[model samples]
Target: MKIRRWQFAAIILTIIWLFVRGVPLDPQVIFGELLLGFILAIFVTWGFRRMYEGQTNLSHGARVLPYALVYVGTFLRELIVGNVDVAYRVLWPSMPIEPVTVYMPLRVERPTAITTIANSISLTPGTLSMDYDDEANALYVHTINGRDPASIVAPIRRWEDLAIVIFGEEADPSDPAPDIQIGGDIDGE
Candidate 1:
């Protein structure tokens, strides 16, 4: 596997850190770790972007920092709130469970961004992305308690706007449409 510069640099820096910390490092083990790290990095990059041709730009990489911070902030807050919400539902005799599946229409065009949003929603508590229908241009997500399908789209779309800024900019939401089709299922699985 071809080694990217950052992957090599990360390996080198990690080795140096271990040395500075007085951790024993065998030559064979270090070589193996370097190879493994490089391979994993390549795979991760490919999964993130099918069109990414390994053009490593340090500047572009830095853009992820702000996006990551925002995502983490939102994730943590939602996680805590979700936990409490679940706890309340469990403890209450009412057992407030809507268990609804929403078919959300997507406005984003990039597959990577759309997938990111889908994955994020799935990862968050109380919701799961079931499927996608490219022909219908929509996403089917199962939510623990939702009043309507639009509820899923609103929050995800907001985060998607932030994600667009984090990863790459696209056409305005108000721009004329090309009738891209999509649809999906909401089984929370």
Candidate 2:
């Protein structure tokens, strides 16, 4: 009777994909695209069913739009800043690059949130997410400039803060922010 969250997500994603693919707005073309989208939505929903299980219901209700907008805006800004920083380091040979591996603790408990944050980090230009330790809830990140572990993790913490709200994760007031441990210089210095 009622469509599940995964099914809804699949349907929306399919429609977006079709639109991006330049499906025309003519009645006949629209009908055909809708039919195709319906078929693909079914398969996509089935394939990703497990992933939706146990996920936070944050995306289901009224707060979804605002949270999505905030997350997207913050991510875009960070992505741009990271790109420019990397570009500057590359273009200016005199720029000091203190590459270091940082162990960043995780506050979000949801698997989806954790994975999203990790992927976001890797997507940024100056940082690479090397690995995640589930047991420790820590992420190993390598950054071009990591002289101050806190500075390196500050943006990630901001991302995590937004993700907590977007993903409906409970923030623990008593739990201190994750500590960043610099492992060593990337150049073997």
Model 2 Cα lDDT, one tens digit per residue, 1-189: 345678777778778868776987788988888888888887987898886664334335456578668777888998999999989998998999988888887889898889999999999998999998888888989989967777678778888887787677888524578666777532244
Model 2 residue runs over 4 Å out of place are 22-35, 47-59, 172-175, 184-189
Clashes, model 1: 6
| Full-model lDDT, candidate 1 | 0.64
Clashes of each: 6, 0
Write model 1 residue lDDT over 87-138, tens digit each, in one string.
8888895976777767666666678777877888888778888888797667
Query: Number of the top candidate by TM-score?
Result: 2
For candidate 2, give the lDDT.
0.80
TM-score per model over all chains: 0.61, 0.79
